[model samples]
Target: MNSIVTLNDTNCPITTSLAIAEGVGNPHASVIKVIRQNIADFEEFGNIGFEIQNSISGAGRPTEYAILNEQQSALLLTYFRNNDTVKAFKKALIKAFFEMRDELNKRQAPAENLSRMDILQLAMQSEEERLRLEQEKLKLEHQIEEEAPRVAFAKQVEAAPDAISVAQAAKVIGTGQRRLFAFLRQIGWISRRNEPYQTKIESGYLDVKLGSWDHPDHGLKQSVTALVTGKGLSKLQKLWSERDQDHAA
Candidate 1:
């Protein structure tokens, strides 16, 4: 018996019912009757069955032939219980299906210039890169959480004095002078000014103490610097902690 099965236009391996009958050494009419009897079973199995195709009969008259795909052929084999030939035919049909599927895959793969093995290697590499990127993203998120200033600053804020200097506040908050100033501006506590600390003091966000100091090059000069109030410190701490929590979430 010829084991070669031709693929349809869609590159699916198919064999006619007449071919299946010939393979199983059964009459065409008998095979067709059995298929019709258990059609409901085939329909339940995702409608894997046959389609009628025009064929010339032995008497030179045009008749219908049932064209079955791999799935349909396998399904039909279940009816021929204890039949060794049917079992062998099923195996051959399965092998042909796999061959046709692989051929279709090669034909449909992108980059026709590349060999199948090369394409598979590229696919594996692409998957590896995707996984690597995902892992890196998770690691970066963990690092950001671990290094957040809110964790340490929350503790510092609880132990802070009633009032602290801008420098002291910066140190407690784990930030640089420039970054602290920027944060103050962002929070609307201070605007563009020659004396931002003094402005903050006037805005009631800080307490100011006036004093005089002697400079190396200059005579006694009036110096002014503001201290962050207890309330202001609490507010800033809450803001940072909430922001950190939001990012973590």
Candidate 2:
């Protein structure tokens, strides 16, 4: 292991530099021997400006050193088989060493349980299921909204005027029975009747009056011509006829 190998200052740690070169998969007697050998070699090659190179072959010029053992005639290896960050550094150095030097043939690759395709398929399926559930939830929410108003109207109808029919109330309000009830409920003018047979309007005893069309407060105005025209004009015609009869008398 007293080989004259190139390394960088970052990877110059004795244990790490050795651990990387051998790709020690598991802590073994052989791995420890390699670490000790590299550390001894580095101490021997004191600052001769060793060339620094990258782990990858395509990487640029040597940024570090690979100072070998100058004093020791033979290198003694040190073992670093652990799971800590320090151990990880050693592992990376070993991987880089084997890759850069084309020494992978000497070691076995690490074990992996999941394949690339299996992981990809699982990710895609998870996304699809999520989208489908979201769409279904949106559909159910829409249905509930559409039926809300109709359900509210039906409840109002059940609690209508007891003495006066819904039609009578509609006539007083100058609107259809259903439309009038909907408007009453919408405006919060009524509530569910507590009495067994009483309607909401009867229970609340709300006034169903259509005030004068001529009143400004009512916000209704009849044109002068319309007031004296059509069926409305019949009352005026009788009054005029009575006036004519009185003049003849």
The candidate scoring highest on TM-score is 1
- The regions of model 1 sitting more than 4 angstroms off are 1-4, 46-61, 115-249
Q: So what's the TM-score on candidate 1?
A: 0.39
For candidate 2, write residues 1-249 as lDDT tens digits. 323233233324232323334443544334334434465454555532322233367443222323333222123223343556546554455554455445323222232544677666656865776677679657745643433322222122222223354455456545576664454444344333211111322234432322236666767653210001122123323544565588799
Tell me the spans in candidate 2 whose CA falls farther than 4 Å from its real position: 1-112, 151-249
Tens digits of per-residue lDDT for model 1, 13-123: 777778878878898878887777777776664454333232435333223346677767778877886488877877777787787778667756678788888989878
TM-scores for all predictions: 0.39, 0.20
lDDT of each: 0.62, 0.38
Candidate 2 global lDDT: 0.38
